[model samples]
Target: MRVHIILAAVFWCGFVDSRKIRGISSSYKRFYRERKSFLCIDGSKILPFEQVNDDYCDCEDGSDEPGTSACPRGRFYCTNLGFRPHYIPSSRVNDGICDCCDASDEYNSHAHCQNTCWNLGQRERAYVEGQMRTLDEGLRLKQQLIEEGVLLWREKQAQLRELQQVAEDLQIKLEEHRRRKNEADRLKEQTLKALEAGDSGLIRQNSTVTSVFQLLDSNKDGSITVDELQARVALIHDEERVLSEDEAVALLGGGHQMELTKFRHTLWDILTKGDSVKIKDTLGAPDSLGGEDPHLKAADRAAKWEATNLKKVEEAYDTVNMEISDLQKKLTIDYGTDWEFLFLNNQCYKLKVYEYTYTLCPFNQVTQKNTAGTEVSLGHFFCIVCQTLTRRTVCVLGGCGP
Candidate 1:
């Protein structure tokens, strides 16, 4: 009795599983009823169930003959069990060539088709798995780069802040130094005018002569010696070389030194009227003014020192300003939406064409060099645009050619 029951269950399962209509996928099996009449798939007509796969055209829309090529526009399904299910044109059915991998299309033909769907499916699965692994690795690397880029961006911002602070400090110092220099100059001018106006015949000379005398007489011994002239001025002779000691003495009225009165009568006139001497007071010399009023001498020295300090401060301020400008420009660049491409900033790539080598500097410019070493700029990086269909981005270069 148990053996009979098992036999009956196996038969029933087989019958139920084999109830699918010919050339119809399992999803459409409900429409292919086992009853007497068959309704066209488009509901355009009703036909007898025997005409479903008959070798005769029945319905105008070819819906009643999907399993055969009876209708020119009909479609035949290939239930490729081990791979993908598909449909082929009805004209290709039983045409000698095996259009379906399972040989279902050539059911009544002599042509043979092999079941290669399983092998094709295996290869497709492996390809998809490889692509997934590659995508995972690419995403991981992208995340790492983005992190690194963020750190780099923060570092740059820190540098910018530090530079901005330095520039601000330098500006303040520059202003202070400028004020000190101006005050010193005003005091020195007032003192020199008072000394020149006094009846002390020691400096009964013009303001220009008096100023020249004070600069040259760094030791303030009431006279300017050859050593003092050489130390105080870069006396260019003949517009090409330094003036010799003899030349200095000749200009100083045939003596090695000249008092203020003789200097006015000789060197001052020559300096102002002739090109025999060029006196550029390169003033950074030590002075001990024993013959002049201590206050006046102190004022002159203070003015010279302040002027030198102001120059140094100006130079430092300029340097800081330039650095700030450069940092601002770098910070304003567009790295990426998430700063992902920041790692490529200032990085360069190269490619060689037939007769030229092209260099691409990210966020900078593109240039090409020929075999002869002549380089031409292609363009500068302008913007980036994403192509929707391609799902990729392209950089747009501008300002030159392309």
Candidate 2:
């Protein structure tokens, strides 16, 4: 028996033997119920079931002759199978229109529609699956980047916290050392005045800052450099516990050499004040957390530290904020128009033919990219299924399909 299908209807002509009809969908399966020697389309009218598709209308609703043009208002269902099905008016039955992929609508016509059903089905299935794979890959990458963004945010937060704490510690230590240095300088000045006034008894006691300076004047040049200072490096340790070469030079008035006055200044602090804290360049590195500016006066180091620290901290904070904004933008793009289309959000779909390349970017715009030169805008893209078939159904010829 030959089976002919039209839109949503099925009929047996019992004359021509050919391909089998694919199983009906759940929505149309209800029509097959309550079958007997005689059946009505609605089971309300009784007619021989054999009368179906006999080229004449029977049921008032025109459901009996579903596969033929027996009723003007009846509908035919095309079981497109692998693709989406469509409905056609029953009057179009055998009217030479290729309404169904299986060509059952023109089943009895001499120019019988060829069975392009399986070929079209296979092609459409492959296209849909390929599209799905592309979306899946994009979704995976988007998810991975989002996770990385979150990790980066946490790491930056921790780094900023650590930087803040280190800067604070440096500030406190720098202040304490500056104060101790001041106290030591005052004592040295007082002792110098007493010596100039001819305090011979105190001089003989050999406990003056001048005596420490004279001991350090190894070359008798009445000054010191890194080379001369190395000899009394141990004494330097005793005073400040440690001193960098740069700081040593800075204490001597911003030169490679320190004269007697400069030597006395630090020497008094070190020798008379054994418990005095040593000054370290805690603040001024190429990219230090915080520290004093060596070239400035000791009084200004505190202010400089605060200013420089604030600048660096603010810059770092702004960088973190910008990164957060970028991540948020990525997130917005990751889930475009709808969750299913997230991969397509901000994404461009292209189809290249002989003459031009067509592009569709969801929720953005459409364009035709000429293969030879310039591209032109076609229209705006939107959400219809999120916006299904916006404007019109896009189609292309040849063996290819979208």
Candidate 3:
């Protein structure tokens, strides 16, 4: 009788220490009571409490057979107290394979499962901590890049404004130079017309006309003889003939010889006015009196110089305008909400694959080069998509693309 009492006491102690329900988590233990009748978790039916985990399915929802594989939809819980808690399907229980880290799923099977949940949980926590640190560092660096990129964008805006001002200044200068060129051209035309109309007072006083007379007077006698005029190669009658004696005398006012005063009065008009008179080459060359008046030449040179200056100013203006256009286009781009991608504006990256090398210039173009150094344009920088700035979906046929 004393032995029976001791055994009964031990059983009571064991029952109190482990008020166990198989397969149920601690949170669900209140539902499974030791009452005479048991209710299904879905309120489908009531059964004898002894029917729970009895290796038979009664409840349509499989709530009465949580600990057994008798119900196909039943679930089994593993109370991995030292690590993490989770649930396993009822089918995985006692199938000769351990599905729970606590080895409880194979309790009726021959397979042995070790309780490795605590060690696995430690490794998982370490990995998660490392990933957290990496993420924190990455975010910090990203913020730093955003700050620098904003400054870069500001600098670009300033540069664009300065260029626009320069373009405006260049446009004003270009207009001024064009005006000067037009004025010089008009003055040149008027001077040539006045000289052609036999304005002899200017011709007589001119040093260039005196020089020509001296050149024609080979004997230096202050008079140009027909022999002297014939001796000089300055006169050409036509393409196939030299000047004749009669033509030379006629050029000197119907006389065999003429003084400088008469020669100037007659020969100057003939040389300047008529298409019948042809001067062959420059002053010191074989055709000595070849060109028009020196004053008119000087005016022509001044006009030409002004034109050249105008052209240079126009070119400068155009260059500045092109720069302004490019800057405006760049500013309109969506680098990022915070200009975080502004640093990659003119940057390039190269990648090699097989025998080809691909080059990517951000906000510019993409090119591919073969091993033989043949480069072909693959595409240009279209709009950014999917948060990657360099990736593009199309090509344009132009200076920046295929």
TM-score of each model, in listed order:
0.66, 0.41, 0.64
Candidate 1 differs from the real structure by a C-alpha RMSD in angstroms, to one decimal, of: 11.4
- Model 3 vs. true fold: TM: 0.64
Every candidate's lDDT: 0.73, 0.55, 0.72
Model 3: weakest 10-residue lDDT segment is 393-402
Query: Comparing 2 and 3 by lDDT, which wins?
Result: 3
Ranking of predictions according to TM-score: 1, 3, 2
Q: Give the runs in model 3 whose Cα sits over 4 Å from its true position.
A: 1-5, 13-19, 25-43, 46-50, 79-85, 106-112, 198-298, 381-402
Q: Please, what are the lDDT tens digits per residue for candidate 2 over residues 312-355?
A: 55565565556655545444433322234344445788898889
Best by TM-score: 1
Tens-digit lDDT string for candidate 3 (1-402): 999999999999977645446798878888897889889999999999878888899998888888889998899998875667788889988999877888877877889789888887898789889999999999898898899988988888899989988988888888877876676676666666668887746544544354455545645577988786665534444444566888887877898888867766877556555346644333333432235564465446456656777888888888888888888888877777788878888899999999999998977877899999999986565633222443444433221222
Q: Which regions of candidate 2 fall more than 4 Å away from where they truly are?
A: 1-27, 33-62, 80-84, 174-402
Cα lDDT for residue 28, model 2?
A: 57
**Candidate 1 residues 261-354, lDDT tens each?**
8887777666544344445434543233333553366557667867877898899889888888877777777777678888988889999999
lDDT of 3: 0.72
Q: What's the residue-level lDDT of 88 in candidate 3? A: 89
Instruction: Give lDDT: candidate 2, residue 141.
Output: 79
